[model samples]
Target: MRPSIAIAGTSNSVMARCYAWVLSNSPDFDVVNHSRGASSSTVLPYALGKIDLSQTDFLVIDVLNNEENFVLLGQTTIEDVKNNLCSALDAAAEHGVVPIVLSFPRQNFLNRERVVHDAIKAYCRELGVVFVDMYEMVEDAVERAPVTVYKRSFFDGVAHIKRPISRLVGSRLADAIRRSFHSDRVATSDHALAFDRIEFCFPEPEAGLIERQNGFATEKIACLGVGESIGLMDSFDVVGIAFNSEMTDSVLSTDHEQVISLKGPDKAEGRELMTVILPTRFRSSRLTVTGEPGAKFEFVGYARHTDDRRARTRVARRSVLPVPEFDEQFKKDIALLAVT
Candidate 1:
């Protein structure tokens, strides 16, 4: 059977849609993508924990660009981003899947610091996982052509490359995959223990967390009126609230000096909004969520992604090349676009 490849990435990966588009055309692999636009690396560990990757062989992760955005916005730190990457790697190891970390160029490649991409490379080396650096690839491609032309024709000049460049990149990645095949290597227990395991707890409706609602009710959905509050006593990296398909604003406070303001979906329709208290790391912490005034939304069940230290890892019987190097032909094809 052909190996299966899965993607757990951010908006760039989704917007490019290069990997899946190119890989699916091949006869050697089955592809699936689990990516969300406008999301950062903080959410990947939570997502990987929820997604079923038991049948997956290779997992590609690309969130450096988004992580950089968060870092620049002062919402998170480099250390926290690295820790999130570690947690994500640990989650991938649970399924005994080979993980490839893909790093893209920063939006302002010429001016911005490469701290996040450098950190990603460092983590990939430390964890013994594959690392693909598309930043260098794009940089080299631009050198072959005028920067303005490359920016106008190929790149969105922000975060994503155009479809043509995306296809070229995707094709090169597919070629690399075809060359190396699948890896049987997984992270060691000591490696996995280096990070905290993410755990979620969904409170029961009868738990008295919130008043049960009559309409649009489920075990997981509790209703909170304006100024209503719910509390959880435990160790948690973050607390999540599944608000109804309505716009609401809430605040999450920890026993320590931490208060997180959360906003539900902007629109009054669509899926339930799952917002979390972030930039937090507290143990045995008491958490409180209070709806602000005019907060009219179903509480849904209260949930939290707590950090748990557990030691578990799979043994690797063999190893394959982790990084994918583009062939001469692939390099030539990318360069041809410069003059064409």
Candidate 2:
């Protein structure tokens, strides 16, 4: 079947419109055009279910700076655009769709072109989203023009560009869509793996907990088992179990008895002592440690399955040891690392 694609943006989002037009004309695509009235906010249409589609393979957003008076309003900040784009893309991802973000077209009146482009690039990087640099592509085309040619041939005014630009933009965008479709097909086909069961365990450190210190001794640690002894990198499906302090023992103490829903990895990062942060005000609970005899206390590693759809599981026990607290200072450290 032809891959299903959705185009969403403002009325003057020529990039989106052009993409729709190109996809409609392409033999390999089934296109859905969802572009609405030109505006800064796209969250409404997405949230209202107007753009929702089943089996949608790809989504394109091209409405960042397409309004009539956008440039005159004032300079737009990176945070403003990043938040809106993240919200829109997050909604699409909730339905298992991949999103493509289109950079704003290059306009001469905008003084902070590089800043805007860099911000968009950084946001995409942090979120692991795909990006298309329409501005750079168009700029290259303009620079190659004859010196005597009027800029009007390329752009109508400072902000809005002309139709010929659309054709050039459309052709390139169509090529990009085709390439993206091909890559997606390959990825979906190659990454399918079936699993019967998966488990994840984290070690919690309180008193009476077994503590292992790494070389630096900066952090006290515990070991959580990733069920089945499979290689850490092997991607598998899993079921997730949520546990509060009160219900800790019934879940983790048993072996694969009561599991919740199956879940795949939402996100994974470099290995560290994964600690579940409970509300500070909650009363402390107790847990039976696995290896350490006579150890029992509050604070447990949260248990979840690699596949969330298949089973429901919960923390069966809590461990006690001396662990570094993930307090406000730790959070600030993380924030600084993120900013740098």
**How close is every model to the real structure, measured as TM-score?**
0.72, 0.46
Instruction: Kindly provide the TM-score of model 2 when superposed on the true structure, using C-alpha atoms.
Output: 0.46
Candidate 1 global lDDT: 0.57
Clashing pairs in 1: 220-301, 221-300, 222-300
After superposition on all CA atoms, how large is the RMSD of candidate 1?
5.6
Q: Which has the greatest TM-score?
A: 1
Per-residue CA lDDT of model 1 for 187-211, tens digit only, reads 4443543544444445555645443
